[model samples]
Target: SDYSQEPPRHPSLLINSKVPFNAEPPRSALASSYVTPVDLFYKRNHGPIPVVDDIERYCVDICSLIGTPKKLYMRDVRMLPKYNVTATLQCAGNRRTAMSKTRKVRGVGWDVSAIGNAVWGGAKLADVLELIGIPKLTCSTQSGGKHVEFVSIDKCKEENGGPYKASIRLSQATNPEADVLLAYEMNGKPLNRDHGYPLRVIVPGVIGARSVKWLDSINIIAEECQGFFMQKDYKMFPPSVDWDNINWSTRRPQMDFPVQSVICSLEDVQSIKPGKVTISGYAVSGGGRGIERVDVSIDGGKTWLEASRSQKTGVPYIADHVSSDKWAWVLFEVTVDIPYSTEIVAKAVDSAANVQPENVQDIWNLRGILNTSWHRVQVRVGQ
Candidate 1:
């Protein structure tokens, strides 16, 4: 209960768990804005909230397998140039509840709202590398130091006496275009404890899990993070492979997620008035491949209509800074006649041509991760 230090959240968010708090905003309110308010943003944590006392003493260790290591204090990181990125962060299990409908899969049963967009301010990882030191990295199959690993400050039971950690390809961490950051602020304010006060890593275009919170150390290494999170979890497996016959190593850690969209409102089993009915929700693609289009169908997949995409606002500030990559998300709306009972379906196409699978069974896996299937809601359109 002392997790209250995380701050009181918007009462509208659906709380999936307490203690080590995890929750998501109401589906109807999730995509209502270009930048989700800090209070309404989704919260996902694996363990207790780590309190980093003495903000001045907070430090991030930068270790290099092939170069000298350095300790960058909070002030040191802040002294570096800051860049702002308006990006969306989604859990790998954003729509796990849908997948669970087909078969039981392990995870916090997240609805479709475990995602949000916000303006994050911090020093770019690439610029930090340049100002600090560049570790000699190699990509060879049998080589040394090809990855960048991160260790969190919060110890967790999930990792068995270890901190939650993750990693990315060395190039992904160092490439200026990748736009990774040591995010010190969320929106225009310093991060709240629940969101990694002091500092965290913002890995745009990747799953939220990759953006380690309470960032403690950055390490350049020859291998991917050896953390259990990177190895035993956050992976997908064929439905045929159950716990009895599963080989965790056979599957690669989930990196870029697939294209996905959802009809946030007008949910399943809801009764709607006949005549003109409106539908709206959010769509996003992973790996920096922006959503190209979102299609909604009222009578199942037989027919479709294009929803109006969220256009770049004419307003100034970093809103204008988001490039065509548009790593945030697209809020869409479409109004049409709903004369009878029908299944409302939504699917998104990413710039990479990745289309959401039409059914959860089509992409069903043992772990229920990456539930990017077309979102369908059966609603009765009477009265």
Candidate 2:
């Protein structure tokens, strides 16, 4: 099975990159619900999708930097209990288009569609570690600082890179509260080819890069993952640092993202019916802090209307996430009159009260990783 072959994709997805296939659903299609449909979910592949037909040979080697290693087969992982987690996986570059407006930036110019929520089903990462007999934490001097490094099977083009990789604090990985999983299913269906068919890590509440697709192996390290994606990329740099004087090694990889929201119902310079119109979009925050409120202003922030939120309710497979601290995205709506052409604005606050920055220049960085600026769109009153 050649990994270079292109897989079938949903016709509705707006293609971004072709060879390595990156795409996202249209803005209107995303407002449909809290859980994005698997077919319509945004696909962000950095390299060729490895052909994975040989399930019997598909094994994940669990090695350690400071302890004994182990190899686990797919049979061993599947034998464990399955847990369904309703969580949102958002790319770090989800709103790069907005950031580009401030200044030119490098990397993929993704719009708002790079973020989506889905019900992921797999064995809890904590349970998997316990089954593998990872050493328990103790206050003794023998305690090795734990970092769970996930290595992806796909080859990437990053500097000093062979494969896409990432890692999170082992304490966070083993903590039941983190809700991490080696997810084999998305939206109740086996993962599609574009979404890591055989296996992928689902690191709820963090940037999408942390959830390595097409997972190949795991390693427990004493320090953070030294992979390219972990160190040189997916990090933010101050606006002052231009490409000529940029140092990729200076910054740390982004973990929990800042509060962010996007206006999905309307695009820039889109025409709309006269009088009152409904404005809708999706809002989400990282690190499981959850969204607090989304407010929309049609007249450049003079007056505001609170948007009604629609989060997932009573999905039998997912429990307790329906609350505020839930890890899923919240679809919001509000109606405002558009008597004449004017600027439409929206900003959201996460549960931690971190409000979305209104000005992109204030938060502008070199890579444009976290662009949570007040999402603005131009609407003209017309038929």
Candidate 3:
């Protein structure tokens, strides 16, 4: 693969892999702000980045199983009303390294920084589909199309060097409330090449894998795309299944992630002053579910205290608030008196009352995806 065309990245990012360019910001960087800066956002790539020199000529083809296919230029998509959707995208492999410690797991090794929230500016996909005659909230087309597949220009070994692709149900794609976007801008500025430059699909509240970058085309099909990431990869499996006996088809591609929380203010193991220590981190849930609560335990889950949650500075975060950004994450913090060496843990509950599993051992899978177990860190107090 040609690495010459890859764009420059932030030096502060901790590089997990250099070839395909996967890295994430430091844990402290994540807790420092609400909307993560674009450069600080985690980078996960399966293949070498694709370069698009002619933005004017770059177009995304929209094809249906039975209707005439249409190619939409940037100008054509831009004509629709622009909506800024704030959403969090997390890799399914986030915290895979921790899972690996429990048992050897396959995939990129990531800490808790594998997630980030940003404001995406783009044309609503629902509105864009209407231009092609697909009505809002459409579940099926006259041609029996039930899924919307997004194909990318970036190719990877997973697909035998073919462009990366994934799909979402057509019903979700057409729901205006889903906030799906063909985003061209991130954080109020034009998207950098590291992200999908000219355009990319942002499937809010879903795992980032389905949100394909570097737009190429869209397909309306009767079934989900049989892409490698969609079928053989990104599925949840039982701990009993190993590579030899594993059956990929037995499981479904994971969409909305489970409730998760992480303590970013401290590392996995750190020494700190013995007085009052401030604990800070992020808590988020998938499928537009709001974070109902974040619990922090200083003595290793023996007892817990509720942490204050907020999305914007000075504003209290209320779960499922009518005015809250349902697709974004909430920041939680609590200052506790730590007089001795102890273990700290954080866990979250979603609006639906879904709580994170207590242990990673229970949720461990061969692929190490969706390790939404309670986050724990050991800390030593200085005399």
Candidate 4:
């Protein structure tokens, strides 16, 4: 079936794009306070969504700058013990909308929901790398060598180009703590076409684009993949850079994502009964630091309070659940006594002591990449 044509509808967020992919539902749509359902998770695709059949026929090829190429068919790959992990896959451009507000940038205009956590089931990439002859290096030395590149079979009608490919540093590829995987299944079921049917790379702590879907090739290289996506796109630029003055080659690709968080509840102009109202959301830091805490402020950063991050105790509106690998996400909440007031604001921090930047202008780039800033929602307190 062409699942891409009939993408699943999600209730909790607003849809920003529909053809190439679907953005998250608006924060106001998150009625429930826990993990987002699999079907409802935001879908982001850059090309024609691929359809895969005959699992036995599926094959993944591994190559290197210095070694012989190796190929693994579906059966061969599945022979290895399967490992399951719940991880959050977030697009690098999750908050482009906020950045776009400061100045028009290129690419899909995503709101806060471009991220979703799911239980991924598959053979670990580390195991596959070992099978293909990656030497066992100490944890500290893993990042020392080169880069591990990934290519997708899913094709896009390039205005003028070849297939899509992306990669990450070898250090990131080999980190056991990163939990990179060749995910064949998502949320306990076979992957949907929109999400990469037969397989996709799941690089837990890197930008989502680096986790290429319809994964076909894995290469170990001494440098980042020189593909257009890596060489020319997804890079950060000074706030002073603009479309006309930009030099793409001078900037580096966004390999690791920055710490980011968002307020997923309450919408601008929404009204709530006066009294105690709870604010809740998710926070995560890329590159495997994990989120340590999320602070919430009701008065627009005038003061801050630690949002509850415990898994126990019924904190209404707070979703404190997290996955085992801690690669998924941290749901947090803070209850505030609202007098008949005018507006409310909230923000979060991660384990790296990285707090979301206060505004979009400071981090604006020509491509609108890496937009993690304080997410604020204005609401009215009713009498």
Candidate 5:
């Protein structure tokens, strides 16, 4: 009955804990202008939290290896037509504390706030897999299928193992730029219960344990996602492989999640009120290919400025104004003029040139998974 004591009302920034696989450190860690305030936006559970009683007896089982198994509910999926997505869910171990400082790797040691950027409304997992009929199999330009598997109702055991299941693929569950959702709501309302209330599965740009929460089943598979958190823990070895010369089948399960950025308004020991110090953060890139620019370095990367972005309404490439994937957050800013004894550092760079990995021991891996580097915070100027 330990639902992690269920109490994340809102405004969160915890980041890591292990009892039930916790994590939540990325609303940019709430600073740099803040806006991930959906109950602190970082809860990556793996087990024990399923207490769903009734969203009118919520269901959601739409299976398909070839087909058969339909189950709708939740008012037959909210009577369709409701697609609102303001993406960003990052957590391929979102910067696992820079790969646990290059070593000790296993799970849930996150430090980039596990990432968050809400606006996710609901309905549109390809219109509920074409209204649960599920048949859309085409793209055989010569048989080359590989992913599309999401199965979660939040069950677990492993460590002497038994239950736990997770999956993702089928070109990121049929990419329409990977909108892939079944979300009941978040940043709008409803899904609270440690965030898998009646439904969950947001898969934007992949990773975040394949975006599966209480969601029951969704398979379009060809392979990949055999479970065990996708073929034996989020694969990525090298840094001279550890955990017994790791070779978990030629390592590879971490679908798209590279260019990242963070530095959510200074705080290592915060205290700045001298002249000017207005740095900001939040940048993303993974499959969708949007975040075109976010470069801001304070004397650490030598010299880099250009950071003033924000524009996600109607998205027409910033539409003479709003264009960067609607549902917001590309936010950037800069304003420096420090003196009262310095020690500030910040870093970010996106838009596919994909910067960030400058440290973290050359992309440390052994299951710590893709920890986008450069996110230092240590300010002090006051007086």
Candidate 6:
């Protein structure tokens, strides 16, 4: 593939791989704000970014296993209702770097910044499906359409140079409450090529893999997508399983990510004076679950303190509140006095009462995906 026409990236971003352009913003920058800036958003690409030069002529083909195909142009989609949905998209392998320490894992070596929250504007997929006689909440069509597949223009090695693709259940796609969108705008501005210029699928409360970018088509199928990403990659495997005796079909592709929390104010190892210190970071959960609370531990896992959580400034965060964006992340902070060197840790609890695991090894998988373990950082105090 030709890699000459790549888009410009933020200089502060830590580039993991250059060929397919996988980079993430600094950890501190990620937790500094509720909504991540577009430039600072993590970029996870499998192949060269495909450029869409002609916006007027761009269209997305929609078809099913046993129905006539339909095409929706950019103008056609824009004519529908526009919604500003604030959602957080987190990679399944968000904290793969920490997991690698326990055991070797495959895929990108990301820290804690492979996630971002943004307000996306676009027509609901339910509305778009309605245009073609598909009713809302339809699980299966008369012709046996059960899943909705998204095909992208970007080609990747995982697909053997074929277009990237993924899918979700038809019930999820047809449910307006799901907030599944065919997004065209990000943060009120038209999406840049790096983030899918013409169109993209925004599957809120799900792993970023299912939100395919640079969209080319949508297909209603009888079963889940059989693409490389859906079938082979992104699926979590048991820690005991290795490449020699791995069975791809044994596990389903990861959908919604687990409850996650990370400490971004300090690095893995840092030196500071013996005094009061402020710790802050991000907490989020999948499947529209809200963050109920965040627990901070100053002396390793001995004792814990409750941290304040908020989405908007000056507003108290309540789980599942009308004002709260259920799909977005909440920033947590707390202050404590440190008289000696100690280890700091942070863990989160979701609205469902699901708490993050205490140890990485407990949830450690061969793929290093879904490392929602307690975030720990070593602190060295000075006189």
In model 2, pairs of residues that clash are: none
> Residue-wise lDDT of candidate 3 within 119-219, one digit each (tens)?
99999889988878899999798889999999999989899999999999999999999999999999999999888988999999899999889999999
Residue lDDT tens for model 2, 1-383: 23457688899898888866889999889987777898899999888888889989898888854446777778888898898998889999988877887798877878889988899988878787776565333111135757888998887777333788999988887887788899999989988778887899999889999999888898877788998888878888888887799898888889887888888889887898788788999888888877778899999878888887777455321213444437877788898778888899988887778898878998888888888889999988876
Predicted structure 4: clash tally: 6
Candidate 5 — which residues are off by over 4 angstroms? 1-79, 89-122, 126-130, 133-166, 169-244, 249-261, 264-274, 283-337, 345-363, 366-368, 372-374, 377-383
Per-residue lDDT for 100-125 in model 5, tens only?
Answer: 86577777776666777787788867
> Which stretches of candidate 6 lie above 4 Å from their native place?
none
Deviation of model 2 at 58, angstroms: 1.0
Better of 2 and 5 by TM-score: 2
Worst 10 residues of 6 by lDDT: 314-323
lDDT over C-alpha atoms for residue 331 of model 2: 80
Q: Against the true structure, what is each candidate's TM-score?
A: 0.94, 0.93, 0.99, 0.88, 0.33, 0.99
Candidate 4 — which residues are off by over 4 angstroms?
Answer: 1-13, 28-34, 138-145, 157-161, 310-324
Candidate 6, residue 215: CA error in Å? 0.4
lDDT of each: 0.82, 0.82, 0.93, 0.73, 0.66, 0.93
Kindly provide the TM-score of model 2 when superposed on the true structure, using C-alpha atoms. 0.93
In candidate 3, residue 306 scores what lDDT? 97
In candidate 2, position 195 carries an lDDT of 89
Question: What RMSD does each model have against the real structure?
Answer: 2.9, 2.7, 0.8, 3.8, 18.5, 0.9
lDDT per residue (tens digit) for residues 158-237 in model 4: 42335678887665566655678888888888888777878888888778878888888888876778887788778889
Per-residue lDDT tens digits for candidate 1, residues 1-383, read: 24445666778888998867899988878767778899989999988788888987778888876557888898888888898887889899888988988888888889888898989999988777665556323243233667888899887777876899999998888787778889999999999988988899999888888999999998877878888888898888877888899888898888877787888877677898888878998888887777778899988999999987774565321222254436778787899888999888999888778898887897788777889888899988676
